[model samples]
Target: MAPSLDISDWWVKETQKGTPVIVTTKNHNYSVVEINSPNTAFQQVDKDRGKKAKRLDLFACEEEKILNDVEPILLSTKRTLHNSSYNDGDRLLDEDQSWVLNNVFQHHPNKATKMGEKIDYVTVGKHDKYQGTRCFFVISTNSFRADFSYLKCLKNYVKEKYPDGVKAFNQKYFQKRRLKGMNQQQTGMNQQQTQ
Candidate 1:
């Protein structure tokens, strides 16, 4: 049996506040929050034996998964939900309890004759040093617009999804600096008037 990790030890303590820690699944890597549960087992394995299993609480961010698979391809981040105990059934190919997923090709359709040969959309995300934010950007091959416009769309998407988080960041960090500048200007004006 593989050693079970305590819930508290799952996260890196030193870097927890610095940046989001990424956990890699077999299909793709993503940001996840580890949630602990008392009744970890959701389903039963053996009907006759009445054996219960512990399930890990891995809440993955869907947006992060989308950002990683930017090319018009399908992505699967779902793995079997089991903790510590490794069973052959937990392997992704177990057809009895598992189903095959076609990922990207099933979702998007291209009418062109050489549709399979060309990519319609490209996925992209990066941390902007000037803006100090990270988000996903998609560029469409069919569209005549430039890539920068796509980035603007991506920024808006992130802001819409995380309005409160973005607002807090602006108020705490960016807006605070601007406020400081305004205060300095006022102080300078007062000193000039006094002189």
Candidate 2:
């Protein structure tokens, strides 16, 4: 759900001061799905989601189930949660239970699509990024416009006002920094190898 720009001066004000916000869902454990980003709150328009949307304590639900069902385990929060004192489920998919979903798609493609649609516990949907593979997004979105108009305006202004400044800064510090650093390290290693 994208919000229409009806209000001329509408902008998202940051509510959380970086002190860790919590979600409302009880079972989201990030096991089978990846919470790409668990943010983006919006006011609900419909009857069912209205209450949750208005709640100040709740954050926008974010989840992404890999179409291949082999979503990288690195993204899973299971280890971090289990190891940490904060065992509370952060509404991400449970990594421990993700073992059930590991080879569902590779071994059975047809079952994946069918299960995706009908299954209540496991969310199923067509993958937005990859074609033909079925992916599921369990998070229900709100009627809010997700855009970078604010960033776009800022970018345009910066581009117009400080083209040389950005270029110079990148040239001095940002541009090719990674490649240069890696090349230097590799060159040193090569020199050592030759010696």
Which sections of candidate 2 miss by over 4 Å? Answer: 1-161, 180-195
Summed over model 2, clashes come to: 13
TM-score of 2: 0.15
Residue 109 CA displacement from its true place in model 1, Å: 36
TM-score list, all predictions? 0.19, 0.15
**Prediction 1 TM-score vs. true:** 0.19
lDDT of all predictions: 0.33, 0.33
| Root-mean-square deviation of Cα positions for candidate 1 versus the true structure, in angstroms | 21.6
lDDT of 2: 0.33
Tens-digit lDDT string for candidate 1 (44-102): 33444221111011212443333333212211211212222334223233331222112
What are the RMSDs of all candidates, in order?
21.6, 23.8
| Clash pairs, model 1 backbone | 70-123, 74-103, 74-104
Q: lDDT tens digits, residues 42-123, model 2?
A: 3333466453333312221221121112123322422432444332222224552343234222223234333443333323
